[model samples]
Target: MTPPKTIRAAAIQVEARVADIPWNIEHASRLVDEAVDRGAELVALPEFFTTCIVYDERVFGCSLPPENPALDMLKEKARRHRIHIGGSYLEMRDGDVYNTYVFVEPDGKVHRHDKDLPTMVENAFYVGGDDTGLMETSLGPVGAAVCWETVRTQTVKRLRGKVGLLMTGSHWWSEPGWNWARGYWQRFHAGNGRLMERTPRTFASLIGAPLLHAGHASVIEGGFLVLPGTRLTAPIRTQLMGETQVIDGEGRLLARRRYQEGAGVAVADLQLGAVQPRAESPPRFWIPKFSPMLYFQWYHQNAAGKSAYRWAKRTGRLRTWDDGRNARAAAERL
Candidate 1:
């Protein structure tokens, strides 16, 4: 299919309250409204926007169906705003919970894709999805990768020949031991945005596709902000907070929103019809085609990895944060 000459795409970087299901839905809806007000025809939200990335019991306890109220609200918003909405939620399917990204069209049609690779510690709560492909939409062939999936080289390669618009969802967090002079703390604190700048551009250049990355910037301690009795009393640290970036087909920064910046929508105009070829010519060097480390991790995280995690939980290598929601039992049934 021929792509559009141009489209107003928006990356919504907002604060997500953990496990506050109804509130998160309302908050995301308001942001979608703001994006529509800014003339965005294609809007994308950060990863797990409906539930801040958390492994707490509440999230597992309240796993919702694909047609749950939160998604229903997004559908109504998409129809009313006459725009496309994309984001994810903790979804239950076939008696298993998967982190699923739902793409909603103006006509209320929904396309779903599960996160094929779950990040560290996420393997415990959600099962990884098996299929990966582009979604045919009004904006042309749109595709996405949730969180760390954007950094999986093979995953990005798969989308190269299949998509024109690459909309991503991510929740990058502050690394451990955040200080002024060491490691990610220094890079994130005073790098003039260079640290966070390189990722999306690299993905765009590699994929040869225009990309929009929507990310959460709020200070989420343990990726859980609203959880009871765990809220920190100190001021929220702002290190390693992720950015919302728009990289063009030719690997140029079209627009961006930095960490801890005032929340709202960051919009970019992309000429989808002008995107580069689906697959660029192969490089001269016969470098390894895939990351053995990542693929190994992916393999273990699927079925076998869950067993290892269960052992860790039993042996005390892992600590369980129970929010009194019977999440373990809920996950067991799934």
Candidate 2:
């Protein structure tokens, strides 16, 4: 089979209002319209674009069924516009709520994925998403994951040969305070911060394809777009919010507009030449080099209390989970 081709990508660096679902949806819908205007077949919104940066119980309380008005609105938009919407939503399922991302196709059909890892802040409210890796879409075998979810969402092993396009949504929150420094340092030192951002780019490189990374960067931090495969042709391209960024398939930045705003656009000839593979080298991406098997084995051994507790609920006595908080309260009395 021939190698995968390069794909044009647009990352929306939006300013999502906190706790406003209707406005968030409208803003995201507007972004989608703008992306289509620029000829972007696949467009991505920031994480939780359907609602404000809803965290904790806020995400659950605002949650709705797939058929809810918000989602239905998106369906009609996708079908009418002929664009694929890439992002996650806070969804209610089986009385419980989940932070889920859906790849809504142009036909108005949809595929869903839940976040594998909930941030420390989110642990207080969300249950972990049990599934891992990517889900398929008409665009190609696509992978959908949320921020922080990239860490244990499955070491890039499950990534290979499964999907050609890596679409990740990040609802990363940070305040310029003590906790922000603490959390930022953790992802930076361990998760490779900006550098590790290339995990998807590297994956696209390995399988000889291009990545459409729509970084969940909005408001405070701005946003980014990577095109290692396309960089050789033109490192600089316009991005959402009137900004421009030159990013490597390895998620490295070659150039960018330091401070810009209000929607921008960029495009790459996705059919750009092949992203050659190493002749005699082992896979250089994060997953292959790290010995994922042994690492994950130890991960759960020292996992956080929240993760451990969730695990018990999924595998032990509480296996048949219930969402009605009243039911649990009643069980406690029994």
Candidate 3:
């Protein structure tokens, strides 16, 4: 079947709460309905739409089974509305967790693409996946990416010429909590926010495809890990960088909803086809230039979070919904 020249798409910005799967799913569902009402044939939700990810221990409780409520909800919505819909979530598979994106088609077909790498403190909760983010949907060949993946050159390498449309989302948060250096951090976050606002269009230009990017928008109060394997933590209050937007293949912004605008949907009619690249992809790993602080945090937090993850798995402390179900089944057999 030939792909449509234009389709109405929506990117949903959600103010998701940490470790609250049920509430987040409900909130996202309402927004999905709103998008559908506005004639969105394809709806994309933010990364971790089922539950917000943080450095707290509660993040361990956010992992769901392969056949979980979040997946079920997407399937139901797609079938009910006869439209395509998707989002990423923390999923447990074979005792390991991954940041998995699940896309559902109107005919009930499902496609999955796990994030290739975890970002910052996210390393503590999930492992990276190896699949190419490309999916051959009924609509066309589409690429799926999560959070920082959208800002990486490696992602461009994988899907640049193969995909006609790029569907991506983020859970990107503000700078760390250091009240003593609040002034510096505030300025830092402001600069990063401006960069994030340009990311969707910039990335679209690189991949030479239209893009639909969703994101989270909310103030989060949580703990920052002071040490890898201990309960020691520092209070962190931050906001999500919600740059929900729709951009064309030529890097033109069609629609956008900023974080300060709160939770909503950014909907637009997109010309779905491959186009000439507007910008050359840099040879570096990251597409954007990172400050010294961000560079340090990226490496340092990655190591710390990995150490914490090892400790949690070794101690059998990384509990997930599948674990609980297995325990219940065992008890019943006994």
| Residues 127-220, model 3: lDDT tens digits | 9999999999887898998889988999999988678888899999888667788899989999989888999998999988999999999988
TM-score of 1: 0.76
- Winner on TM-score between 1 and 2 is 1
Query: How high is each candidate's TM-score?
Result: 0.76, 0.63, 0.95
Which regions of candidate 2 deviate over 4 angstroms? 1-8, 54-57, 153-155, 178-193, 196-200, 203-208, 216-266, 271-334
Give candidate 1 regions above 4 Å deviation.
177-195, 223-240, 277-334
Ranked by lDDT from best down, the candidates are 3, 1, 2
The lDDT leader among the candidates is 3
Total clashes for model 2: 10
Model 1 lDDT tens row, 1-334: 4655688889888787767777888888898888888889888888888766543444544457656877888799889888888888777766566878889999988888898867754665567897674788776787777877766666765677567778787876544333445664554344424535566776677666788888787765443222222322222343435688877788888888887684678888876733565344355321124345335434543444355335434544342122223456798889
For model 3, give the 10-residue run with minimal summed lDDT.
224-233
| lDDT against the true structure, each candidate | 0.67, 0.50, 0.89
**Preferred candidate (lDDT higher): 2 or 3:** 3
Q: What is the lDDT of residue 48 in candidate 2?
A: 65
Better of 2 and 3 by TM-score: 3
Error of model 3, residue 199, in angstroms: 1.0
